[model samples]
Target: MAAGMLAGQVALVTGTGGGLGQAIALALANAGARAAITEMPDRLPLAEQTAAQMRAAGGEALALPLDVTDLTTIQAAVDGAAEAFGGRIDVLVNNAGINVRQPAFDVTEDAWDSVLAVNLKGLFFTAQRVGRRMRDQRPAGGCIINVASIMGLIGYRDRAAYCASKGGVVNLSRALAFEWAAHDIRVNALCPTFVRTPLTAPLLDDPVAGGDILRRTPLGRLATPEDVAAAALYLASPGARMVTGQALTVDGGWLAV
Candidate 1:
């Protein structure tokens, strides 16, 4: 890989077994950042495969097991990535998330808890641990990209828990950015409108839901993982050095109306 914008940097991306997390990790590695790809223990094999692909393309990469919901695992994963990447992590992508689609009136307490546990709660603790590491690192600066959703910025049916969790993520990124600015830590949220990933393919394949989404988007199409990955790349690159505490949307004009 030729030296790219992120050359010599180290990035830790969670939930890299597939989907947006995998795409972002590959993009960062291809851009010359050493990547630490992490996933749940059961998904470690898939993450390893992703790392292998990066390595085959001449990019430095490693796969680690991480369960964001568990504080012990979050700390361990952060420490492991930092240790593996020369004791510093230049970028952190808080991408581990889950959604339980159901009407607000029908949403069970368990469902809400599970969604928030992985989406909002997990993301917060992971960012907290990584932010601390970034603050104390010799350079005393780094970037954090939280993968929020356009649903976070707008209302939608059967997504009450998801929307609530992602909304928290958007605001949380801003709060963290404000508090960490003095440490030179830039925090931002990447809100992508309905990307076609494995986790979302079923919904996208539904004629009713899918058609409605396409109609609402001025661009007339759903987002691809790469579309969101590109935005994440910019946030992690030197080009966005002055950018912080903002929600960058890859919604294809979904909110234009």
Candidate 2:
């Protein structure tokens, strides 16, 4: 409810080239935070475009190249963002993720590995690096929001690898929250249902599959990037200062049944 609540905050959001990541970055900027937008090397330009949009709308922003699976690159980007943004990172939105949909029996080893590498493994290390910085640097501890999914909380067909990876994220958030409590670094997750994004386009394009999804959801609609962004903004704000180790479900009543 408090607008401009993050006026003096610095937020680092991963995978900000497009989709939910870009939306979150823009939302953070809109809410009065300097944003560091990080993405894969190939997507650096897209990240820059997001940054440009942020700047155009009267926000401070920086675009950096990152490979979430690579520790060295993650560390460098973290350090770079801190240096560029006055030696502190108050918020981290772990939004970088990937999915390879396949039935359990049909899933290939490479597909599983790649999905976990990005969604689970990459998320953990990125948080580790930023968590350490926040624990040691910020006098006022920071908040971390992991962009998980409703798939993480409940099973779905043809999403074995994706579900498994997000399930790890769901629990990892709790573990990190407990461990980091003493350090004042709060950790939480944003579990959204089927959102209208590139990631869900394939499944949503299938008339039968998409219709089934909507029929099952009580709200009967897909989530928007802005919907997820608003939730992320709340998690990053002072309003949620006491909220941690929880998965704030942004589903359209999909899991209610």
Candidate 3:
């Protein structure tokens, strides 16, 4: 891919304190887009670190406090990003999500609510807010990349709520894409298999669970943040202009079986 494919574009990525979100933010910046790296209030410092890295690499970036679960914060972050980027937000990356691993029979209301709240509800509201900005901007239209998971396509143990939330994201992307097509907005979901991140370290480090995952995957390896970031860059680039309402999987053939 050519460098600076996204020159002058502006992007807002949620939950970008570290891991996949951080990777996506960096990739966008490297592609010549001004990045708005957002995280929870307490995690803002980490986001600042990411912004600093972008600057060191000769990219523009800024850190913002965003708690997706809170509607106020979502609106604030969106407004701040647009204001900072000359009243335009070309890309929205809904990467903020949480998972609660529990058996169906043992799942509690709180656990289910929390997972859905962040993964689905927060994603929806954030997209809605960003979509509004995208629609009203001078050259109305933007790309939305929702970071889903392979679990959305295939069921897995101890991920009931996660599966449901990601499933919702897949369908929601379709619905939004169709609705926003007239406005030039494109919506898509990015689904990746188990990725090597701090959040998944515990599971990936467990011999029993990790071995089972690798055995099931045709590639026999967990995805890296860069793997998923590349897909996101494609979705946001001009190359994917005709692509929308699709769930692009970076699962290393995990779903082929």
Candidate 4:
């Protein structure tokens, strides 16, 4: 069990239905933040599970159905979290994203649109809604952590759209961090290499391509969701009060190599 650093705060982690999102949500809750775990209502279940686990551990948590792509849902989730807690939202982890990897030319327009809609397009509007609410709050603004990918820092074959979207995310965080300083909102980004997640399970299961990835990571092992969680915790905690617009990489030294 990691030590608590947040102690007293309200955090919302999007895409909390599973994998990296669930890990971050649990870590925040354990650290004494009243975490709101959000996921789409239909498919994934990590949000409720994470919320329940936190409650059992004597931490405050809320599981709300949220699709980050839907502005209406985004507003409702943020509003609901504030209402359930103390009309305050101290942190928001923008971890919800979608990616489709295929040869650049072979990728369909729908695939490209789908990835951008959730990963890049929706994020701007979602952040806007929360930023406004946080700004309006008295004497206290909020922090926003965008979960980007190493793909943002480097190019990968068959991931042109993904690279572009995440690259946008990285820059957006930097720009927003500078612009929102006056409002006391600190914005940053978390960039990780291809961590093993359900989204990548099918690909990794194919022994041929999976072995190639393991060789690229200098750490000699693929990262788990918990690994990324630790990084997120640092940026979300008071320990990082001065940090903003930074893209902290949690990849297994993939960039170093």
> 1 or 3: which has the higher TM-score?
3
Q: Report the lDDT tens digits of candidate 3 across residue range 78-127.
A: 99999988999999999999988899889899999999999999999999
- Where is model 2 more than 4 Å wrong at Cα? none
Residue 190 in candidate 1, Cα distance off native in Å: 0.3
**Model 4 C-alpha lDDT versus the unseen true structure:** 0.87
**What's the TM-score of every candidate structure?**
0.98, 0.98, 0.99, 0.95
lDDT of 4 by residue, 1-257 (tens): 34667766889888987889999998888788999878887844667777888999999998898887788898899899888988888889999998898999898898888888898887887788778878898766888999999988989888888999999999999999998989999999999877778888877887977887788889988888989998888898888989999999988888998
Clashes in each model (backbone N, CA, C under 3 Å)?
0, 0, 0, 1
**Scored by Cα lDDT, where does model 2 land?**
0.93
lDDT (C-alpha, whole model) for all candidates: 0.93, 0.93, 0.94, 0.87
Q: Which stretches in model 3 have alpha-carbon errors above 4 Å?
A: none
The true-versus-predicted C-alpha distance at residue 117 of model 1, in Å, is 0.5
Best by lDDT: 3
Model 3 RMSD in angstroms:
0.7
